[model samples]
Target: MSTANRDLALKKIELVPGKRVRQKSKLLQYIWFNRYLYLMLAPAVIYYLIFHYAPMYGAVVAFKDFSITKGILGSDWAGFKHFEYLFSQDKFWQVIQNTIIISVYRLIFGFPAPIIVALLLNEVRARLFKRTVQTVIYLPHFISWVILGGILINLLSTDNGVINNIIKAFGGTPIGFMSDETYFRGTLVFSMIWKEFGWNTIIYMAALAGIPPQLYEAAVIDGASRWQRLLHVTIPLIRSTIILILILRLGGIMEAGFEQIFVLYHPGVYSVADIIDTYVYRIGLTEGRFSIAAAVGLFKSAINFALLVLANRLARLMGEQGVY
Candidate 1:
């Protein structure tokens, strides 16, 4: 086309509506045209609506004197009585401290473990050996915490257990790992790493697979050693994936593995092992403090939401993609 004709065509395009408005109109048209496709999505939509969103109405009970006889709507308003009760209890602060400490320990030790494993696996040349290692490591993740808890109890037993037997062989006293408060938190952290590190590596391995081979080849040609290539080329490529996963981990700081703690913990280690979810279970179901438990749960959800938003904002500020 001639230059004048091209200029005229550009002018005509410029006279059209803004891109955002046009995009929305096109999306509506496409959705209407392929309404059957959306019909296929109805089951998932309905599932979330029914199971996830519909129950949110019960959250109002957190601010009420919730009674089995009185429905949520019919319950008398108690303002923040439950919340005030929760904040005043010393046990509540202890549970909060335990939760934060355990989460921080997991973030420190558990987070980098999978990344290290994935990097080492990437270096392995023997496919059979690599697959065998991966299979063995991943097996623990599929085992339920209830079963694993029993296994741990047996293994860490002070009498006639494998670890205690070894300790006796070395002339050291048998340690009550599960029962003693001193060792209980360490046991929790180690158990978590053993159970979930392999499963977590799957994500890092996938990210590693997407790193271009050309970068490694170029690094090699530039006289980079194996370690140099890994440090300079591989790490930088997966940096964004690491940052994204870290942000997600931060958002879950309030939830410190309820099932594992519940299964492994006893009255002996309650000082170190009690956390928010376990406390909620004890107060809500066992003690029948429904309103107080609901208030605590609501507080937990609010904190999680705030952390998620803060992490997303930080990611954007650091020039990475946010979850939003």
Candidate 2:
């Protein structure tokens, strides 16, 4: 309000580093205080830089007529030729359809499962039973898809599997779940949820723990039922986390589980399960259509990048936190 005070404030503003310098200093201080944690994260950062980022340079093959001996740098550039080839194929649309359908199924069924489980677990009074149930559910997540796919094949095998045994006892024919295009995608999605929901619940459970206990106590005092408390208080508290995870999950829409699909699929179900990654593998390694495979890979990455950016923007617009 006074001239001297206004001049003093202006001088302080002039002395203050641009926003970037102050932010960098703050980040540096935080990092200094958490040096050990940063050191632990270094391996993952390096892994991504080497395996994920460095290989991005080879994306140029999407425009090149790649040759084995020529390598990426020496490959002859043929701009958009592979992309044209990809777009001309009927299987391209089929792959896109399968990818979208499977991802949508996962999002619809898999997303809310952990939240529901976490909410139920949060309300449990008995710690021993809780621990046992959590352990049982989470154990499957550690198993590789290779082993899981094998177990699925055995379970769904038409000859003498457990599911078929039940079908026979009921006077019905046993279906080859893995081989049926109609059933294969559904089976994979459900199995993925079964194997993953428990591990995913760990994050939701941790978020649930951070919600203030006083809210639940207040809800009880207000004569709210258990379900009412969960719906009104618990869900609201963890809504941001749910939104964040949903955005991140949607960003991977182009990437249906490669390992699971590859192992579970046969020629019979290839129409439904042949996703971008497996297609790339067949072309690049098996067929030696290196440039075409690289093109497909690049296309997949572009779509994923677009989705990530769009989701991040939508998340911000909706007042939710994003991975950025």
Candidate 3:
């Protein structure tokens, strides 16, 4: 609203009685006007409160020598003991290194994959072919990682796997993509890209759809080529979305697909593929070290939160609307 008009409205509201009381009435009326919208939002708000925020109370388990029989609040306080031991472990540092390296590999190779695919799909004039391709690629996103992991094991198995069979047919050596430490991380990255990149492409495609046709029309009139139009127009319009998704991704740098890794990793590939989440699962859940597990989970949350805030701050400094 214009400053003058807003001041005029406030003056009219103030003339009714106590200025603050009238202002409060206006705010209540605004809420009343949008009551149905708020009603629609209630379930989502309640979900987060119950499933996300309420469980935060259990984070104290990280600081306590927690016993399941004793419960969270009844446990003896261990102060920083859990965190101290977590930091002291050389294995913990190796896990951290693996996590960062895997996350970086995803960021470098997997991040731009969707953008490239979305751009290519956007340029395709054959709608039938495009739809077929989209459906084929997006199918994996709906399937559970367990199923995909099994399929990948069979497809890439060193002992007469389909891929190895093809290699042998072509007079090439059978390489262990999943079992060999040299190829394990790269295989993880490739499969990750193949599995989820299409889902991300949907986001980019949505953003591309929102671009005003008039902008493209203007570029065409100005004798711009398709590449020029994309560079000067399409990318600039979707810049905020790219920035927002990137910031959210940075926030989850500690996560390296726990489900996928858990299903696919074995002792042979653990050195390269084991991430922080898997380590926590081994010590915290399977080994029943509740306090240490809670501590590691809390540490991961703290790092993610800090990265989110930092990424948002940097995005705002760079004049982009980051995910707030």
Candidate 4:
């Protein structure tokens, strides 16, 4: 090469390194400026790393014939044997079906409950009355299902329960809400809605509050009625929030409330109430089938991840921004 060309090549290489160093310094400076904000986020990041992501390492047991004495790494590799065992069982299918049914019921019924409550609250003219209503509904969320379970038992028991006595007063037959198979699933769905719907409304309430007042003014000047304003102005603004929450909720479809179900359900209702989480509790902790339990837990996680991805893709296809 000519001396001029060699000199130009060296200059280009020097410029490239100088440009990269400037970019790196700018990134560090940006992070340093935002250090306090990141400091606030550190605890949450640490928590997921410690409690959620750290335990993921133990998922190796799903592929192992795990023994407490042998430990995770020392155990013999089973090579999908545990999953094959799970697939071969009829009870596995039953449990999966029960889980999907209960979750879908909640998705259909419970998902709309919060939105409806938020809308009603939005319409209320009396601040005092609306605040009281919100407090009354939100109280149940603070109480654990253990306390609520005892309360429900007294209220819904088939034999001389509070509700049953009221029914008998009206010359009606008592319903077996807790013990019978027919009513147990309904009871589960209803109780979940009653427990969670109020708490869930907080998000929708915030979404409603964020709507620009000018848009409502424009709608009113356009001669839109209150109902028309809600349909045309309110719902459209909150659609993205609804889609975001729904996508996140779909990721937990397999979790059918082990604490609630275990507290209320008995063998009579097992056909309908037995779900993946409860089954994991029974087979893993109660029965000490470590490998099988690990297999079930891992499988549940895979399904949840797939659903989250699918929901995000569908949301994007509908021309909305979804969590990626």
Candidate 5:
């Protein structure tokens, strides 16, 4: 190569490194300028680091004998022994079926409840009445499942509960709402909707608030009725938010509300109410079968992660922004 050509190539290479250096310097300057924002975010970052990421290291116990004495690292490797035992148990399959059934019931009824409530609330003309209704409905969400479970048990008691009294007044037999397998799943789905629908509406309501008023005005000018405005203007504007929430719901299909089921279900209803989370808790905490429980949990996490990715991809394909 000629000296002139070599010099030209050297200059170009020098400029590339200089450009990268300048870009990095700008990034550092931006971070320094926004130091306070990062400082505010530190607690959340530290929390996830300590609680979430740190515990992930212990997931290896799922593949080990998992002796508390031997420690996680020193535990003997057992490969897929625990997983094999998990799948071999008929009870595990029953729990899996129950989990899916409950989750599907929640998805069908509970998922749409909030949207319907939000839409109805948006249509209300009286602001004071609307706020009162919202406050009343949202109160259930703040009650812990342990307390709510006791309240439900009392309310559904066959002897002297309010519901049974009304049933007896109408010459109908009082039903075992909590104990009967036939009624247990329905009770769970409805109770979950009652507890969470109002709280979930907050997001939908915020999304509705973001819709442009001019869109509704334009629709009205074109002779659209209230229903038509909602269908065309309101629904379209909030479609992305709906899709995002649906994707998140789909991601959690394996997790069928551990606290609610654990608090409410007795052995009589276990055939219908026992889900993967509850099963894992019993096996791991109560029976000391940590390896088996860890295997089940790891499997659940894998399926959830896959579902999340698939749902996100499908959302993006449908021209909606997904939860990345």
Candidate 6:
């Protein structure tokens, strides 16, 4: 309470121990031991530093009237003009709603798909079959969304498309999956799951591999069945990994597959399918509303950063290792 007492309390607090000469020497020794490996990683580190970290400097454009003629340095300061306009736009809220709906749907339906696939793969007795299935599923993840979108367009096209053909054969009405507002979101969510679920499963399978056989042995000895052992031991052990992934997902709350939306979206479904990233593209590049786009991007990034911090804090409170 008193200034002197406060000063004394501060003085009493110990500083964190720094790396001493011995520790420094040990670190150097370890580094030198794997010098070649470090050398291999150097280019990637430098690339990220130059390309990723350096570009963050250009975020200043959000506060300026960025002009090709003036350049970033000579651009006129606009203060918070873009930000104010961004909030005033009614479509901004619509884009945000679309982003949230798509992202939340993906989280609900797409997130667990890989986990289920991994579990099923783990249960398979035949290694060859499991590997084959994994390979087939993972192959889709490598295909570019541009190509996949084309395929989806043809397959879901209203006029004699594969899906429509099947629907007609079943005496059902042909639905325009891509252009229809009702089905557009569902199609996007399902297509994303189909594309990435297998690749996502790899991480969960790796985590499953680290699970000790001894736990299962103990469970079996205690008269636990396979399902019970899975429920108790396997799920519980991988719970932290799942939570960590969920927290990381929360960090990207505003990002709802830019590539997917850019490729799949059409004018008819734009109301429901247009997300923040797509809106930014149209405004910034197409409409030449550079500052407005920058403002929207900044807002998205700020919310993502805030969500990341909150999610990390929640993870820590739940006794899990957070990204921080």
Candidate 1 at 201: error in angstroms?
A: 0.4
Which ranges of candidate 6 are over 4 A from the true structure? 1-27
What's model 5's TM-score? 0.97
TM-scores across all candidates? Answer: 0.89, 0.90, 0.92, 0.96, 0.97, 0.91
Q: On residues 236-263, what C-alpha lDDT tens digit does candidate 5 reach at each position?
A: 8999999999999999999999999999
Ranking by lDDT: 4, 5, 1, 3, 6, 2
Q: For model 3, name the residue pairs that clash.
A: none
Q: How many backbone clashes does candidate 6 have?
A: 0
Q: What is residue 165's positional error in candidate 1, in angstroms?
A: 1.4
lDDT scores for all predictions?
A: 0.93, 0.88, 0.93, 0.94, 0.94, 0.92
The residue-by-residue lDDT of candidate 4 on 1-324, one tens digit each, is: 999999999999989989999999999999999999999999999999999999999999999999999999899999999999999999999999999999999899999999999999998989999999999999999999999999999999878689998999999999999998999999999999999999999999999999999999999999999999999999999999999999998988988888999999988889999999899889999999999999999999999999999999999999889997
Give me candidate 1's TM-score against the actual structure: 0.89
Q: Where is model 4 more than 4 Å wrong at Cα? A: 1-10
Off by over 4 Å in 2: 1-34
Backbone clash total, candidate 2: 0
Compute the lDDT of residue 226 as modeled in candidate 4: 98
Shift in Å, residue 162, candidate 3: 0.6
Per-residue lDDT of model 1, residues 121-143, tens digit only: 99999999999999999999999
Provide the lDDT at 276 for model 4.
Answer: 92
**For candidate 2, lDDT tens digit of each residue in 1-324?**
999999999988987777769999999999999999999999999999999999888888789888879888888889988899899999877888888888889899998999889988888989999999999999999999989988987899889789998999999998878777778888989999999999999999999999998998999999999889888998888988998898889889998888888888877887888888888889899999988898888888788889999998998898887878
